[model samples]
Target: MTPETNAWDGAGKRLYLQEVGTRDGFQMESVFIPTEDKIALIDQLSDAGLAKIEATAFVSPQAIPALRDAEIVLREIRRQPGVVYTCLVPNKRGAERAIEARADELNLVISTSETHNIANLRMTREQSFAALSEVITMARQAKVPVNVSLSCAFGCPMEGDVPADVVLGWAARFLEQGATGITLCDTTGMAYPSQVRALVADFRQRFPQAGLTLHFHNTRGMGLANVLASIAAGADRFDASLGGLGGCPYAPGASGNVCTEEIVHALQLMGYDTGCDLPLLLLAAARLPGLVGHDVPSQLLKAGQRLDLHAPPADFASWRDRALARDQPQTAVS
Candidate 1:
């Protein structure tokens, strides 16, 4: 293919980003971020031009104590008119709670890998699907959309090399069961660029009208590269977290999700319209370190943007003049 026709060319394209920090990220934090603080941060993110925000998970508080106040947080936060506020719902009860709390959407997760399904959800894939199907029906009755997130879509920690067909098979099932979208999750950061391109192309071809979102982790440092690949393969939506906070509890080597600010910076530089406010995102990311009480994996938060130039040393001009003079050839005494 010519350069113009290259699949990887995403210049001038529009991309949508969904912020998953408050729900996915905070669940992994050892110290629970205060409920008021969570609301404030999410309100900040709401104004940062994100298309969607996963506010919190409505699962059992015992399962994820950090997000125990999901109901309160969901109710208290100020919702931006254009942004969709979603909540993770693990079952019928969670879905009911999320709907009651006025979540705009419900995100349900089921792993494509059987071992991971058991490890994460403590149920077989079929059981999880059946259970989530009921949640989907309940959501439909409530007039809320459901987005199913397929974990280990790339590879599984316990059962490695989950086939692309198996991944898409699960996606197909969810889509057939009234899921409005499918988020292909690289649960352990196992996705590489080539793998992402192939699977995303297949998904697009088969499910052209379905909402496609890619979720990645930076554990192998391939998160941004994978995002580019997915974009090339026609995926325009992605899931990211501020400060790169989040990991799979069941995956041994799991790490944070792709940093939202870093992805926005890279995409904007490439001429893709991400619609996110870089400065606002950075400001929000900056608060994560203080809230989580530790440094985060967000490079943009640490190094600033690539074009954020620094002033030169005080003596640089004099030093350059002396160095240039020394390097100049001296004429022999003529």
Candidate 2:
């Protein structure tokens, strides 16, 4: 596509953002964020106009002690009318717990690579699908919408360079089995712009009615670039974390998920309506380092918005006067 034609196509269009910080971000934190703190963050995010928030995961406490208080956080948070509260469910039990906790949606995850799937879920691809199938059935019974996030969709740390068909095959299976949507995840930040564009185009054509969300990580610093490519290829939904606070243990050199504030800032500047309040998002992001007990990787939070102007230095007038006088030459000095 021509640059001029593609440049303005996404302008003035509506895009949906799924905030995965509290669940995905907190899961990787070394310290446990207090249950109350998690609730407060979710409440703040809800007020900030996030389209969807992955509040927490209903996995085994031993597996993910950081988010062990998932049910409590879900029950305590103030639910906004338009914001969807999603819970990541690992199995049927997790699905049951999520539904009991009154989650608006259930997000299930699987990987396209068999090795990665076995490593993460302790099962082969078929085994993982069988277990997830039970969860999907439970969600259907509970009348809750299910969105399956296919991890390592773009490439796998273990297997490397997962084929497009493998990713689409998993996505198609989930959609055929009653999933409300599919999130193509770059689990290790291996997705590039051209690959994202090609895959997204094929996905849209193959499943015209299926809902699509792109999940990216900034490990290789191409997360935002991949997002732009997806947008160019007609994918508008994405999963991003606050403060860029998440990484995969299985993927070496994995840093964090794409920062929510940074992506929103970029998209807003590009004229896309993300439906998020950028100022409020920054305010929430500013509190992340304190909660996580360390500095975060949010570039926007570190270096405010592009248009946030700064005044001149205290001695700027004297410096400018000296420089001006110096440049004027000695001819006028007499």
* Pairs of colliding residues, candidate 1: none
The most accurate candidate by lDDT is: 1
Relative to the true structure, candidate 2 has a C-alpha RMSD (angstroms) of 2.2
lDDT of 2 by residue, 1-334 (tens): 3121263445688989989999999998899999998999899999887899999999999989999999899999999999999999999889989999999999999989999888888899899898988888889998999999999989998788999998999988888889989999998888999999989988988998999999999998998899999988888899999999897776555668999999999989989899999999999999999999998889999899999999999999999999999877588558
Q: Write the per-residue lDDT of candidate 1 for residues 1-334, one digit (tens) a residue.
A: 1011243445678899999988889998899999999999999999999999999999899978999999899989998999999999999999999999999999999999999999888999999999999999999999999999999999998899999899999999999999999999998889999899889989988898999999999988999999988876778899999988986665545458999999999889878889999999999999999999988888788799998999999999999999999988888972
- Note the Cα lDDT for every prediction shown: 0.91, 0.90
Clashes of each: 0, 0
Error of 1 at 12 (Å): 1.9
TM-score, every prediction: 0.94, 0.95
Off by over 4 Å in 1: 1-9, 248-254, 324-334
lDDT of 2 at 45: 96
Q: lDDT of model 2 at residue 170?
A: 92
